[model samples]
Each structure stands twice: as C-alpha cells, then as structure tokens.
Target: MNISYKFFSSHVCRICHRSINWEPKSPVSIASASRLYSGSPSPKNSKSEDNRSKEKWWSISNEWKIITTIGIGIASWFVNAKQDRIHSRKQMKMNLVSSQLKELYGPLYGNRIVAETSYRAAMKEYGGLRNYLEQARKERDAEMIKRWRSYVWTVLYPLDEEAVDIICKHAHLIAEKDFPEEFDTFLKHIARMRFVMEQWKNEKGNLESTKEFTEDDFLEDTNSSGIGGSKSMINHLQLKCKHLRKQQQEYVEDISVDNLTLGMLNKIKI
Candidate 1:
C-alpha cells in the first residue's frame, strides 16, 4: 500500500480535546493589530479629544473676560465714589466761604468805605480834625464844638456802634482764628469816644466841662492805636474782603470743573 503523509497546519490534542492552530501573520495585519492595542486613538476618541480641547480654551477665555469686567467695574465704582466725596467736601467749604463773605466781610468792608469817605469829607471841611478841635477849644467856639458833636453823634458814633454790633454778632464768621488786634483797638477807641460823648450829653452839652475829656483825648487814642482815626482797619477789611472773594471764585471754578469731569466720566461709564 503506497500511503502519502499530508502535512497539517492544525492538530488536535486527543487527551485535552483542544485544537491548536499555527497561523502566519501578514505585515498589514500586524500593523492593524498594533494600532488596536497601542496608545494611538480611534476616530471617535480623536473627535472627543478635540471637543475637550475646544471646551478648555473657551472656559479659560471666558473666565479671563469675566475677571477683567469685574475688575473694571470695581475700579470705576471706587473712582466715582472718591470723586463724590471730594465734591461734597468742596461744596461744604464753598458754602461756608460764601456765608463768611456775605454775612461778615462784605458788610464790614462796605461800612469801612462809607466811614472813611465821611471822615475824609469832614477833614476837608475843617482843614483837619486836629486843627478844628484845637481852634474850637482855644476860641471857645460853641457853634463849632456843637457841629463837631453833631457829626460824631450822627455819623462816627453810629457807624462805629454798628460795626461793633456786627463784630459781636458774627464773631464766628471772622476769618482769623483769634480776635484781631486791630478790632480790639477799635473797640477800645469806640468805647472811649462813647464815654466822652455821654459825659458831654449828661452835662447838657456844657462846652466848659468838655475840657475834662477834650477831642484830643479820643483823637490821640485813635491815632496812637491806628484804628478809627487811621487807615489800619480799613486796609485790613479791604484785604480780607478781596481775599475771601478770590477764594470764593476759586471754589466755584473748582466745583464747576469737578462737575464737568464727573459728567464726562458718567457718560463714558454708560
């Protein structure tokens, strides 16, 4: 019997009752197997990874945008609040200055001007205050003395009294922190003059007893003190009024500029 043995690629183990197969693999099939088991991603995985990357980018961008917007808003609020506080403070200061000017300095300055003008006119009429007083006293001129008394009673005394009243009532509105030396001197001068005038009135305008407190007494007091008889207080009042007016103007301009700037800022914010 001529029997041919055929080579088999597969065999079965009879004892285990299992088949064993030996197959040769091609390069294409090996590469495909490697791709399946390796770290390389599939099409579905690639699409999902791309979506995740896009989501991360968008999240980071949005977060920064939100943070920037919040920062700008907070900064703007702080700026506006600071400006408002400053404006309020300036407004209060301006009001106080206005009150001082209107109620105190303005009236004081005006009164001083009128008093000075009246004094100048009187001096021109009599050649000089001292000259008139001396001539009236030496000549015992009752009419001249009476004229002097009338001018004092009607003009000088009244004006000085009114100024004192204003000073007493509006002391708080004075620009200086302490009472001014010129003002104190003026008060003393006015008091002395009032005392002399009252004594004359009590004596029934007796020109004889007027020698006791002559015009020289009060006139010399005022000249020495540089208050009523001189230009000291007038200059002081004029300077104070000018300074206050300038300050008021400055405050007004500053407030106007602040308002304009704040309006522009509001528009920009809107």
Candidate 2:
C-alpha cells in the first residue's frame, strides 16, 4: 500500500532566473507518477472545450435554418404570385364569354327578330296588294290603277327600303359557323334584295322625272328595264322573308343563354 502525494510547489532557479517545477519523492509506483505528470486534460478544460465545440455546431445549424427559412419564403411568394395571375386570367376569360353571350342573345338576336317581324308584316301587306291587283285585272276594274299607284308609292317603296337596310346592316353579325347553311343563304338573299331595292328606287326616280310612271311599265314582263316585273320582285321577297323567319325561329330554339357559361367556354380548349 504505497501512498502517492502530488507535490505542488514553485521554485526559482538562480542561474537562469526562471520558474522550475519540483516533484518530491513519493512511495507511489513509477507508472502512476508518470501518469499524473503527463499532459492529460483536467475536467474543467475538457468541459470548456466541449462547450465551445457545441456552440460552434449550434451556430452552423442556425445559419442553415435561416437560409432554409428564406428559401421557403421566396418560393412561397412565387407560388402565390403565379396562382394570382392564373386566377386573374381565368376571370378575364369568363367575363369575355359572358359579354359575347349577352350580345348574341340580347342585341343581335333581338334586333334580327324585330327585323324579321317587320319583313313579315310588309310581305303580308304586299300579298294583299297582289290579291287586289289580280281581282282588279280579272274584273277589268279601273279603280285599281289609282290604288296600285298609291300603294307602290306609299307602302311598298318605304317598306322594301327599310327591310333591305335592316338585313344588310345586321348580316355581318350572323356567325358563319353558327348557322353555316342559313348564313350563306341569307347573304345571297340579302344581295338580291339590295339589288332589287336599289334598282326600284333608281327607276322610280327616273319615272317620276320623265312623267312615265305607269302600271303597264311596272307590270310588264321584261328584264331589260331595271324593274324585272314588280310581281316577280314581290314574290321573291315574300319567299325570302318566309325562309328567313323559319331559320331564325329554329336558331333561337336551338341555342340557350345558359349554354354560354364559363364551363362551356373552357371546353373550347383555347
């Protein structure tokens, strides 16, 4: 049972004027003495080193956390901005579709219906004149001459002009794809009607100027003059009005205002 003592003393060397370490002789074994004097760390120093290492690790972790947080924040901002833009564009498309529906149903469709009604009424009046003319011709009634002249001047001329103008003005609104067959037919008929009305207007002016406005000139079956017989012109107009009215009615019944929603527009694959 050898006892070990740690000799703790500081001595000065007179020759070198430096502090010297002195170890007193102990009964401890040489290995134990050597172990004590060796450069093994104390508990305090080890604890301090460990604390510094932990602090450095924590600093690096905090820097990474801050960088990750900034990255996430920027990414989130970009995602939200992209979502906002997409939503805005979708809303704009919806609004545009809604406006087109209103125009198609309310103004364009409504005006065309009105014009058709006017045309139908005018045709009916002309049909009455045709009946009157036929009966007068059969009966050799001279009263029809006065009535026919008055009818052509007052009712027929103005009505024809109005119908021609309405058809021509609103013809462009008819989407070719929407009513392909009817649209093409309508354009052709409108061209004919416009031509007929223009010729009648010009001829009437010339007739009035020359004092040659007579029933024989109007009722003649001749294509040389601008008026290719008034009866033929009136019959053609009546047929066109009937056909157009039927087409419009069919179109109105087929298409629905509800069908013009955003869902339907989305289906267009734009």
What's the CA RMSD of model 1 in angstroms? Answer: 7.8
Against the true structure, candidate 2 has what lDDT?
Answer: 0.48
Q: Give the alpha-carbon lDDT of every model.
A: 0.74, 0.48
Candidate 1 error regions (>4 Å): 1-48, 203-229, 265-270
Inter-residue clash pairs, candidate 1:
none
Worst 10 residues of 2 by lDDT: 220-229
Q: Candidate 1: lDDT of 126?
A: 71
List where candidate 2 sits over 4 angstroms from the true fold.
Answer: 1-50, 98-106, 120-181, 202-270
lDDT per residue (tens digit) for residues 1-270 in model 2: 123222222122342343254455664555556756996665567899999999999999999998987787676566556655655555554544444334332343444455445545744764644555565556555455445444445654455455445445655443333543433454455445444434433344631321433444244221011222333333444454455555555444333332343234444321
Best-fitting candidate, measured by lDDT? 1
Model 1 lowest lDDT segment of ten: 1-10
Candidate 2's displacement at residue 195, Å, is: 1.0
